[model samples]
Structures are given as structure tokens and as C-alpha cells.
Target: MKIERYLTNKMLLLTSIFAPINLAAQERPNIIYILTDQQTATAMSCVGNTDIHTPNIDRLAQSGILFKNAYCAAPLSGPSRAAMFTGHFSHEIGMPSNGIPMPEDLRGLSLGMLMKNAGYDCVYGGKWHVHTPSIPNQTFGFRKLYEHNDSGLAEACSAYLDNNPHFPFFLVASFDNPHNICEFARQQNLPFAEIPMADLADCPGLPLNYERNPYDADVICYEKSLNYSAYPTSHYTADDWRRYRNAYFRLVEHVDMEIGKIVDAIDRNNLWENSVIIFTSDHGDGVGAHHWNQKSALYEEVVNVPLIIVLPDKKHAGAELPQLVNNGVDFFASVCQWGGVDLPDGLCGVSYASLAESGDPGRTHQAYIVTETLFDKGGNTRGWMLRTQRYKYILYDKGRYREQLFDMCRDRGEMRNLAVEHKYQETLNKHRKLLYEWMNYHHVKQIRTEVHLIPGF
Candidate 1:
């Protein structure tokens, strides 16, 4: 009798010990990260752009938390994506521009590898710009599913979800669109531009900030304009710019339909109760903003992007967060936290999961978000921008018009410059100090100038 009692006791103890592990496995949600190329934050109808319709992406926002002020670490594709996947800055990962492979040392730090180590099946499809030769490759630790094009990518992801794997999965559906706007602008074949200007009265108008910043003329913005004639904005009339905007909106709508398919697959497979969905873009495109057609400048149109996170069981549904989130870094941190994976040391981001769950607008980790650009077509026109809730400060490494400050609360268009005003000197000084402190904390070695430091008052 005693022998049987002892065996029973052993079984009970074992079950008690393993019960938590089983519970944790059940709680760990499957992740679906949908990335779009060259999409700005305002492209969605949910965000108040009445001109375009993005029902699928708006559906995610309707059922999830939307970050209203999210910025990428870099303005370019490869570098921005590298920052997002690795939870590091572009400089930290040694990817400052397109057409560069992620450094060999940091390959193990990718989000796919981290999730894989946590026992989740990781899969990737479409438009992986971080790899060399600008093609989909397996070196980033994801199982390459469909590498052909966006349509095939959507089909492959849907088919995978339909199969219903046993284990938790992390699926990435990266689409290329609105990026097609670049080709449209380059080809100068805007359909409406080809039509009679009188018939195009229904097209969108130029951006509110279409006129360039008056104080900044010889900076990186001007240099890029002169160097990349492929954009050809100088030759465009007001009607052509409007047609360009119209074409860009159409491309955004095109990708929205592709996203709808993936979301449909998730719902069809009954994964909503145990899956977390994320939708964002690598960077934004200039939809005729400031007479610009492409990214790489630090304008709000290029730097700010759309970030939507849908948690399982509708946790914090329909919440809008205004905290400045560095999408490049915060994305990996949030995913790691959700997957119950231990993040490595020296990661430069904080997980906003707590804030998302509680729906608190006051919650913020860092006071300001900084974006950097080391090189563009203009060649080594390094620049840094510091964005706070109410103001923006920009400093370029090489330009006569090196400093620009705008009170973003008053001037959302960023048309006015306050850096040269005597009254705003204190505000400018505070932001400059903040930028320097951030750079020092991150151990940023390049573009450190005495001018960035605060003067003794």
C-alpha cells in the first residue's frame, strides 16, 4: 500500500511542476508580421486619408492597437529592415543603405532566429531587401516560402495557414507596392498625366507643404534634388504632381487587397484566438510632399510609417497609441516579449506591450526618437532628426543650411523653421542636448560634432 502511495505522490509532483510549462505553451501566441514596402502612415482610410481605401489594413486597426507616431530607424529599405529585424540601429548593424548584406556577425540576432530558438516555426515570403543582390535568400534564418512576387507570396502564405501546422508559427508576408510608385514617377507615365489636364480635375492636389522649407535650401534636400534627376520633379507641373499622387494612392489600394487575402486565411484557419498580427512598412514614400517623389530624406512623409498590432483574444482592441515608437527597434522587442523569448543584452528598444495591454497614453520609455541617414544618392549627406511630441529638430553634417527646427504641434506640415528664431533657442538647445545624449548612449561614433553639444548657460 505504501509503495503505491509513494508512486502516486511522485506522479502528482511531476504534474504540478510541468503544469505551468503546458500553460505557457498554450499562452504563447502565433505571430503574423505583415510588412509592406514604401508605405506611409497616411495611406490607409482608417488613418483619415479619405482618398484611398485599405479595408484589410483598417480591419487590423479596428481590431487592434494602432500606433499613430511610429518612425523607422533609417529612410532606406535595407537599412530600415535590418534595424527592424535585429532590434538595432542601421549603424549598429552596419547596413546604412540598399544593396548591402547584413553583417556576418549579426546574422544570428535576427527575429526569425530568435523565434526559432523559442521553438516557433518561422517562415518568410516576398521582397527581402536586407539580403545581398536584393533577392529572397535563406541566410536570414527564415524558411523561404515564396520568392517570386507579391501575388505568389499571398497565395503561399494562405496555403501554409490552410495546412494548419501543429506548432506555433511566425509568418512574414512582405509585399512590394507603392514602391512601384517609384517606377511610375521615373517612367513619367502617370496615366492621368498623359490625359488632358481638364479631364483630371478629380485627381488629388499637391501636398500642403509642396513648397520647400524656406530656411533650408542648400541642405541634403537640395543636394538630393540636383543629383537624382530620375525623380524629375522639377519638370513636373501642378497637374502632373496631382496625377502622381493619384497613382500612388492606387498602388496603396493594390497592396491592401493582397493583405486582405492573408487576413482571410488567418480567419479561415481559426487562428485569431491564438494569433497576434502585426502590420507595418519598412519606410514611407514621398507622395509629392515638398516636391519630392522618393524616400531617404527625413521629412515626416518618409520617416513616419504605419504600425498596427493585433493581440490574441482582442487584448486592448481599438486602442490608438500616440507614443513615439521606433518601429525598427521596438518591433523585435515586442515580438520577443510576446513569444516569451529572452532578449539578448544591449538591445536598444523597450517593449510597449504593457502600454498596449493597458491602453494608457501616458506610458513612454524614451523621451524622444532619433532617425539617422549616413548616405544617399547625394553621397554622404549624413543627417539626424530628433522628434518629440511637440517639436522636430534636424541637423545635417554637410550643408550651409545645417539646422532646422519646427514646432510640430503648430506646424504639422513642417513648413516653418524656428531654429533661427531667438525665442525658440531654448527649445532648440534642449532637443540638441537630447539628441547628443541619445547618440552617446547608443555609442554612435560617426557624425559626432561639437555643434551638437549644448553650450554652457
Candidate 2:
């Protein structure tokens, strides 16, 4: 009888120890998502751009999972962010450009709504650019909205963190400082100031394809008058390019300072132990890359973006994931999976939650990234691009088909166009087919747009 009693006691002790393990696995951590506006992948020091120093951003990468090949679903703000929120492509929810609403019924419920439904207080501070006026107030489904009304988005986030005290919360701390006046002056109402390039660096390296080439006529004409030029204006002497880059770095530094405030709030509240932090941006700016200013092109200058995620209890800390991840499509699903919420049906993104925990997300198949730009910034259509690891193919057929392809492996700078080259026809055809398959899958209109702008001559 004593032997049986002893065995029973041991079993009970084991159960007690394992019970908390199960509970910890089930306990949902507070989620803090920090989204920056128009930040390129190269801007952050973690991504290999030695020119700029982003210590705070670097720290986040050191303490979390750094995604080396993260990409924006679309290289523009409104559409990219919409995809992040709804987990649906721009067209899937009827949002193809800025200032478009993702109809309430079509929202089908979103990650924020799901978190709110799960009893987590959801707060949004700064840069809520998704339009909803047509549907009236609507709360935009957020429990509390701060809209980063000014340059103190991080301050607002810190305040919100203070008010929450010990509650498990989900906060989207979006900032607009780095976005600045050049990209979308009206989007954030950032007043325009053409700070001369002379005040900045002198001889900043221009994109490889910056030289005025024979084939540049079509693209250059489209951009010169539009203010959304493919590359930065050649008219600005070398010093002009330097000043632009300096201003951009300054903008980034300001945003980083604000990010420090948010981090401080978490530490002060002692929420670090129970909070999962994610940092990224909607898309990238050309900065000095490819001599461009804003996105809307297929080059890496605009398409590639930085992505970092840190989980509580040092889960998957200091890890680097080099797999090509489609942020627009895979981000929300991963967020939902991490938060222990049931994914909204019909979501287009994939979940990296499992691999994130495992620390080594190895690699995945070459996925296609599609982007659509309207002609003249507001017309019916402009162009569409499909980017894989080694190649990028663009179709801009307003009246006649205009196709361009670059072998990224050989011409990482995209200086050479292998599209019309007789020898590379086979490679071009393969990528073209893949792009069409993707376009069809996403229901991209078959109507070909025009090559309104070209930068590399």
C-alpha cells in the first residue's frame, strides 16, 4: 500500500510541474507592432547599408528574428498596408490605390478586429491612411485610435503603454517622420521643402542604371513632368544627390529616437516579459538608390523592405531568416497564428509563426510578387511587375506590348535589359509565364498598361 501511495504522489508532482508549461504555451502575449513609413531594407544597418547608422533598429534585430529577404506585397503605402491589415491583396478587397476603403463587409473581419474579439485591447497610433469616410465613423474597428496626429507617435504609444498598466494589449505604433515631404506630401500632409542637395553629401553613388541611356526616352518622359521620376533628376549636380541622402538619413534617425521611447515604455511597464514585438515598414523609398525618389518600380530599391519580430521569453532571439517572405501576403497570417487567434477565412498571406519559433526558417520556393501602378498616378493603368529571386519582368502595354526583363544575378544593379536580347529569349519566356500565372491567380486585369516611364537609359 505504501508503494502505491508513493507512486501516486510522484505522478501528482509531475502533473503540477507540467501544468504551467501547458498554460504558458496557451497564454497569449501582448503584441506591439511598430510600422515605419517608406523605409527601405537598405536603410537599416542590419540589412548591410553601412552608410546609415540605425543603432536602435539594429538592437531590435539583435534581440529578435531578422528577415533578410522580406518584401512588400506592393511597393507603395496604401495598398501594402491594406494588405497587411486585411491579409488580402489590394484587388481582393477592392483597394487598388491610396484613399480607397476596404468595405466593412469585405473586411470579413481583420486581425485587429479579431484581437478585439479575443478580448485584447487594440490601439492604433499614427498614420492610419486607410480611407473609411465613405462608410462613416465606423471606429475603423479599433478599440482606440490615436492617428499619430503629430510627430510624437512614439510618445503616444508610450502614453498608451503607461495607461494599460498590466493589461495584455496589441498596439500598432505607426510613425510618419521618415515618410517626409518628398514621397507623398499630401498623404501625411508633410509640407514640401526642396532642401538643396548641396547641403548634403557630395558624390553619393547613384543607381547603376543612372547614366542616360538610349532606351530611356519612354520612361524619362513619363516621370520628368510627373514629379515621380524613375531616377533622381540628373540635373541636380552630384552634390544635390548628397543633400537628398543626408535629409533621408536625418529622417530615419528621428524615427529611431521615437522608437526608443516605445521600447522604454515597455521596459518601464515591465511588459517586456509578456510582450511580442514586431518592427517593419509598409514599403521602401528609392532614397538615392537607382536615382529614384519614391516607389512604383520593380527594382530592389523600392520592393525590398526590412522585417523584424521578437517574441517574449527570448523565443527565437538573435536569429536571421534569409527566406524570401512576401510581407503583404504572409504577415497577418503569422500575426494571427502567434496571437492564438483563428485566422480570418479567405486570407491570402501565409503564416511564418511556426518557423519563427523554430529559429531557422531555412528557405522556401521562389514566390512571385506583383505590383500595379496607375498611369500618370491616377489614370486607368500604368504597369505591372513580377519579381523573383533572379529575374524581374515588367509589362507596360498601354497601346502595344512593352516588356522588360533583367537578370538580377548578373545585373543586381539592373543596368542590362535581357528582355529584347535574342540569346536570353528562353529565360524571358519562363519568367513571363510565371508572372502571367500569378497575375491570373490574383485576378490582375489582363488589360496591358503603358510604359509611361523608364529610368535606366
Name the best candidate (by TM-score). Answer: 1
TM-score, every prediction:
0.89, 0.81
Model 2 lDDT-worst window of ten: 14-23
Residue pairs in steric clash, candidate 1? Answer: none
lDDT values of the candidates? 0.77, 0.66
Off by over 4 Å in 1: 1-25, 133-138, 188-199, 446-457
Residue-by-residue lDDT tens digits, candidate 1, 1-457: 2435534553453233222222122578898999988899988999899878899999899889999989988888888888888888888766787777877777787888888888898888887887542334556768888773665678889999999774688888888777878768777543211223334677877788987887763665566665654466677888898888888888888888888999999888877778888999988987888887788778889888999988776667889988888888878877887788776777766566555766777764456788887656666677788999989888776666577898877887778889878999889888877776666666676534544432331
